[model samples]
Target: MSRAEELKQQLKPGQVYRREDLTPYSNAVDRHLAQLVTEGVLDKIAQGMYYYPKQSVFGVIPPEDEVLVRSFLKDDRFLLTSPNSYNALRVGTTQLYNKRVVYNHKRHGEVDLNGKKFFFCKTPYFPKKATPEFLLVDLVNHLDSLAEDREMVLKNVIVKAKSMDSNKLKYAVRAYGHTKTKKLLDPVLVQMKSKAHVH
Candidate 1:
């Protein structure tokens, strides 16, 4: 088999790859990649990023957001979320956002990957999954950015928080919440504890 065919066989559909990943297969990497792009076998998404498009009845399916972002970051230690997710928490938020946010220790600010805009927030920590309490705290952290009424959202957050698992909520606040989130939730969490003891 030719070098192009070897490299093509190695690439899975709907997966992203950096040029460095193709290095072992061919020394004329750029020429080979250009040939593949011209042949419609690969699509270059960004600098040093190429994607193997997956075909479907409708047409080509873009790579999964997590897969694309992880390949771009070259790390899986990032949290993928959107401000729109706050609506699911029933915190009175209703606006849908076009951007996805990635919280990671490595990068900060907006980055364009594969034509999709992502806001990378540099943070010391992030959870693998979105927990109820974590979502509440994250909502408060980014409250000023939301399109909903601030007072109404805050009220709903407090109401919903009181009914959540006190232990898990406390853990989320300490583990994931920032200074403002911790300060805001501390008093309410104290009250929750006091109420629990009395009951």
Candidate 2:
């Protein structure tokens, strides 16, 4: 089988392939990949990742960013939480405000790639198990790039929280535990309840 054919068979959306994965194939693989690029059969998203261009049609076609996020995960036991989660929640929307993508790397500091920023905020007490609500909050905080829109975000968050089942909410709250996030989220929850009562 040819390199192009092999790549086609192995390709999956959201998956990254490295050069080493193609090592045993053939020397002409690079040439074939380049040809694929020319033909628009694949996109060289970053240094080593490639993906079908069609995947980007749904929204912002950030193939390179996705590749980098996946690559970062490969090196550390990290969660694509925060900004990525926010990105997921707002999929298909162009109004998102993710200036620099954030990740909970289970460490500290930040790293920049291809003119984009990635913040790796270290936390010593991240939950061992994540809940849907906690996940949602992490996403909201990460995507809430502006400090001024806290009220709007909190309102949206309350609506989202109410939509969830009580058991799930309990589990989510527990999973998230008591932290600074609650103070930020509490008013939103209260406002949502108040609105519901008024109606």
lDDT of 1 by residue, 113-182 (tens): 8889999998888898887778998998888888889989998898998999999999999988879888
Following a full C-alpha superposition, what root-mean-square deviation does model 2 have from the true structure?
7.6
Best by TM-score: 1
lDDT of 2 by residue, 67-159 (tens): 666565455444444433443433222244455433454545666544566666655444444456666666444434544356665566666
What is the lDDT for 51 in model 1?
96
lDDT of each: 0.90, 0.56
* CA deviation > 4 Å runs, candidate 2: 1-16, 27-42, 52-95, 98-132, 139-144, 152-164, 183-199
